[model samples]
Target: ALVLEMKSLLGALGSSWALAFLCSTRWDWLRHSVLCTGRWHQVRRSVISFRRSWPGKIIMKGSSREWSGTMGQHNMLRFRAGQVDPMSRRLGNLLNMLMLGGQWDRRYYSCTVVVPENVMKDAQRVGRWVSRDDINTMGLLRHNWGESALADRYYPGLYKKLEEYHGVDFHESVMCWHIATDLILAKEEKEKEDFAADKRVQTVRALSNYMMFLLVNRPYMLPGLPQNWLYKQTCNNLDKICNDYDLVGSLGDSLWTVLKKLLGLHHHRVLESSGLEKKLADLIMKLPKEHASSFSETPRLLYARSVAVIILESGVVDKVRLLLDLWMDFLAYAANRCIRESHAQKLSTGGELVTIVWLILEHLRYLKEDPNQQHGHV
Candidate 1:
């Protein structure tokens, strides 16, 4: 009995020490140390074993292999209740929230979130935050007119299309733009050339989908009033339209697939894209020739479709450039306007791209203000 008690005490102390080390800010050092010592293979096997066990299983609802590739890598991570003891599950949640470091979606790495080319030029010229006060939608619109120098110089006609959808509410603006972006992207499927290879087009698509993901799943993180009613009404109107065209079955299936993919229910297949865009394209082709009434529930849909038509009228080069610049602005504006507390809350359970963008901008601001400050201080 005494020997058993000693073993239990030693185990407890070992676990406590392990937890302390994991929670400390030495993860980078640890990763490097394991790599230098040639013991990463063993450590990786042990981590994967733990990941497959009950405690770690609670962190992922779907297949752990499909959700995130490695245990402590830079892949996106998620948390869910799994078939584990309640106490162990809670511990898993706590550990993930406190110490599990992961990056945002790999798709967003192409976005100029860390150092936007135009924003960088402006910052160097003015030595301050150019969009300091232009964080909200209206201010962003005003700034984009002439202040976004590169965009204006290249896509001078873009603002005319933008002005057509100007509004006071940020939620309404995001929905309108999102719908328009979807329509345009769906049409691009018919292009003969490999449009997907274009980085500008890729950026546009990524930011557009990312904004919708936030709108549907994390609306509170955005700078606007609750848009629950608007989102539901939009979905309902979309369902009605799909039903009218007898495409409801396909539409529902596509939307369900997309929702699951967005919520991290599973990982996307290697070479396939979501069916949502294709379904939306089919729906667009079935719209009535005449526009819907302003009071109709589907007014936003009609408006966005019309906007897509106007945008599509431009040359392919112009369309891609205009949209790429516009999305960069939208990303920056949203990141700037989001509340600090919202960012803090997301630090746990895998950080967000917007939060990272905001932090980068803050760091740039500090650098611009104090050029002599050491790099490591930030």
Candidate 2:
């Protein structure tokens, strides 16, 4: 019965008279017989032989061989019944369908397909075919814009289960844009103007929201250095406001006042000789117990403490000093908690803390130097 079924399938595959004619010879029979067995090892060997003799026919022949191998395995498993586990059966069926170009058939599966554990290894093997770099490279080529071969082959429903399981939202437009931007920026010329002009407001807002989310939700990702995309964006926004409006007079004064209030230094003048330790102690006491503990364990606290020492040693109590002191105290508390914690020995936190400390110090140096020139001229 199995041999009869195989003969019928082979006859169906040889529907074209030219294909039947080509498979009639003795060598062709041997090759086709091995491929018809549907065993992966036999199919692979047949594919190798075909490639060696007729390289041009390998692609089409290889695809059929692959499909046959998967289909044969699936049929064998089905017939054996108890030979394969539920997960293995599901995986075999999925692989067979995938090999046979069922990716475009929406009815075959849903947008989210939960992968069985038995097929996870095979899934990973297939995943290597589609990578971020490959996607980006394809995105840049204008000739390939209409329909991505990769997306058509494995998107939306094809990997739906894995997407849901991994919490990956495949429909995020911003992520697509980000990938495209990375590719665009890799060129020598600056693409800033193009980026700024193309839906500038929306892009800026999205980036701002993303940065804020990272800062709040994943604070550990933030580097210690002040000169990063986030900081640059903040400065750019300030510059835009200054250029677009009269900031120095009424609007600017109001903006500065509001900013100071937000920084928790509205009452404290820029130049006031305040006691640093007392203010820090007050801040520490005001924090909730859990927050205090977390703050104390962070390395940022050490960096903050170092900044406070620098400010106090300079013997200047100005707005900058006050802001620095408050900032440092908050970081110090977090750092102290991390340090005391048993499982919080992350070196990146220490690096970030040091970076922030140096940035704050740089700002102070700039402020002091700017004022000194006026004094010297006078």
lDDT of 1: 0.49
Q: Which residue ranges in model 1 land beyond 4 Å of their true spot?
A: 1-57, 60-151, 248-264, 269-276, 369-378
TM-score for candidate 2, please give it. Answer: 0.15
Model 1, 242-314: lDDT tens digits are 4455542221224464344334444322211245445645566556666355227546666677767877776
**By TM-score, who's the top model here?**
1
What tens-digit string does per-residue lDDT give for candidate 2 at 162-194?
222211121121122222222222221132344
TM-score for each of the candidates: 0.59, 0.15
Q: Mark the regions of model 2 whose C-alpha exceeds 4 Å error after superposition.
A: 1-230, 237-378
